[model samples]
Target: MTELNILHHSSYPPESNGHGGSKRTAQVLELLVTNGYDYTSVDFDTIKALKTLKWQKKVSLFLGTLLRFPFKGKNISFKRLKRVDRLKFISKAFIAELSSIPDIYIWESTLDIHQFIAAELKAKGSKIIGIAHNLESLVPCASQFGAIVHHKSPINRFAQELETLSICDEIFVISREEQWLLNLFNIGAKYLPYYPIIETRNNLLEIRKRRALRQKNNEFLILGTVLNPPTLNGTIELIKMVSEVSPANAIIHIVGYGTERLKPHLTGYSQFQLHGGVDRSALEDILAKIDAVVLNQPYTTGSLTRIPEMLIAGIPVICNEAAARSFYNYSGVYLFSNEHELTDFLSNPMDTPLIPKEERVYTDLFIKTLKLAV
Candidate 1:
């Protein structure tokens, strides 16, 4: 039996659950578990290695030179923590956890943790795999020189990200566009589908049965994070803009965490409703109600996870050009370069049409990815 320990970045606490990362992690675990591949994950508290070394070492942690403390990453606050203490903490916690996991898969759960895991995995002669969804790009889009510093850096936070990519036996990105960029850096990679939750619903048949019940119509819609807060600038600014331009009866539902921000400002807005952070079941059920999806995140290269969910649910999607390049929304996604194009598409959205839903499959790509690392 081949045991695979995944060093994943967990957005939500393990028990609290309901986080996208939790969903993703659970899905990967399900695939591996159902297929009989051994798997396990680390809890946030298990990150105590960071707590111990950060305060004690006073020097940066992990990898030969790249995992330095107080890294000047795109997030300025993290830059303040960029001290040797924080780096040491992160390195210790990360390395210790990686020590426990068996055969490893370094998924895009966090940009911060990847390097530490990669460093150890390489040293142990263990199989190491890297998975990248758009989460890797969110932090980069917020600051000045964000892209330049992170992607094309001589001395930057992404040095760790870059190091991890170099160290990992194989790197996997969600989009063809991301894979294209990695190739430029001489990093070999493959493309894979990003998912919302670990497909635990054993009711795949029931899921399709329900979706079939919904009215599959012509005119589509654009909805997203009415529940989750916009961690990336492209998404926040996008919501404000879309609300102003979309049609009177646009059938849009902005679902996720930070609806309160929009609620105070856009009161009584017709055509859309912000359902802040609903239960996962409620969120999943609503997909049938939406005509399409839109993610205007301008910063990153690959597409967001929501885009993938919309596609699997059989909805057409609208997105900025950067987003279009990131995910392979093939039959559904209508791509745009700037606000004007986005507005033009919103005004006249016959550009791209929706497609039928397909029962999603993932393990094959994952197994292949792991093999590359091995």
Candidate 2:
């Protein structure tokens, strides 16, 4: 295959705080490199460096920020800039970088402003691909950007998001479920698995077997950004359920920021330990001690990046029916309908072997889709 030069644009840089979204961005970059594609990563930070006073660029940005202030706290998207203002922002951000145009331009998250840029690049014969991280309409009511729950008329937001996505030459979604959702809106997309993010350690299966034999009860881990509303609620609920069912042992460990809130809920429970966020490297050490990972959220969109990581690592997952419905192919995942089933699984320890074959499947799909786009 011919090596293609690609322009990658995203608000979240891999090194920027270790959130799931940023990690996904970083992992995709790695996949591109391994496949022999030459790509340039440009973020809004570049536009911030561009001359501000030239041709009222600063004024437009200021006005844009002001207009978006109402939605800023809501976390609707990267920057809440109005459509016109955002176009102005991207134009200034990319003017210097686009001097030597690449064959492909990949946008990580879709925003109203991106349409203008995608159109411009398409006119120049560059393949414009948009990676849909999440469906804007499917954001949970508990989320900061939950427009439907907050009376923002999510139908309008959904329509607007779909309209913006229509401009892309090719669409890439994080999960097969998300791709199905997009298809309903007459938008076709290819699935981009996050399996590339999983770091496989040598002798993982043997290590798991040793850990399983040593530990009398299963130790479950709830990882990711615990402070986020959706995560916070789900984690607390699972801990509460586990506490009621298993009072004699400390089995569930919560790791991430905002875990201090768990103090009020876990009054007499010694089994649940809350370790506020640790460094990325430290997280691997923490995972080494645990037997299974927990992902029991009822409502989720896009893809749960953690699922692939846990599956490939040989750690059993105790998730809800919703998650099981989407990721039914994986063998290590355990699904529960209610609190009883979840607690039952926690009481029984099991071995989860690594499915190394998934890497080739994901890599082949990624390369084939990317090559076709070029």
Candidate 3:
């Protein structure tokens, strides 16, 4: 078979597992590479120096920012102007780097920046495939959970999202809820749920075996990058819940980047161990020792990627309704809406049934969707 030249673009390095978005992009790339596709991955920095902005565009952006200052505040207006300029630069760089029009162009995330690049690629007759990590417009919903979300206009944001997504030939959504919403807007969207890569799956199984050998220590793990506003807010709320319920003999293990921000709140709690960001090996070691994983997200715009990881590892997941949106029916998932319920689950944890490795069919489906799209 003749190799098809494909171009994959992302804002972040797909190889990095620092966050959910990167992990998802890595997974998609893994599928494409293993399926025998000739692909080139490009990020913002890849062609940064190849493109330069004209003085007219710069002046226009400055004037626009100045005009919005009184209405949107100086900081927000300037930030918006800066973001627009960056996107414009990236789009120009992307087009300049293209030696020839690719057979397929896969852009990660339907953010305005990616959309700008997608529009440029589409004009060149390349099949545009967009990966929508989340409905960007719904991100402001985080504010309900005490997360600070800055947006000039929700209605405008929503319209922009629709416009961006509509330009793509096909969209891969991380959750079914998002797919549904996009379809409502007459966009061609497919649900491609997250699944651990083969290596990660095997490692998780090994961790499960190690966990089974040790006696339960009542150690529960909460995973997320604490630097994220929603995660930080959720972690704080979970801590408050744990303090209120005060589950006996429970040791809450918090792991992720920027967890030290939680230290001030953990002064009196000796049971709380904050392992701020660990290497993969260290994280697997921690996973092997924990009895269960906790997800206490008060509000979520996208499905939590950690849910599938814990479920596949046969580790019990204690989460609330909002956190357990997609995997509610999965075995070993315990839901709690109030302090009393959370206390009961923590005090009397149940054994989680191991999910068979073969049950992970999403990976195949994800690859199939891409194949069909092309």
Best by lDDT: 3
How do the candidates rank by lDDT, highest first?
3, 2, 1
lDDT of each residue in 59-125, candidate 2, tens digit only: 7667766766676556344343444565565664675456676788888867654566676777778
Over the stretch 1-374, how does candidate 3's per-residue lDDT look in tens digits?
Answer: 22677888776666445588777877788778777766887656557453465778678767765775676553244555566655666676778877887878887756764566778788888888888777767664433121112445776667767877788887788887788877888997877777667777777788777777766778888788876677788888998888767567778888888988988988888778888888988888888877788878866577887888787777889999888877787788899999999988777757865573443366676566557655
lDDT of 3 at 1: 27
Colliding residue pairs in candidate 2: 250-271
lDDT of 3 at 111: 71
Best by TM-score: 3
Error of 1 at 327 (Å): 4.6
Clashes of each: 19, 1, 0
Q: Cα lDDT of all candidates, in order?
A: 0.54, 0.68, 0.74
User: How accurate locally is residue 324 in candidate 1, as Cα lDDT from 0 to 100?
Assistant: 62
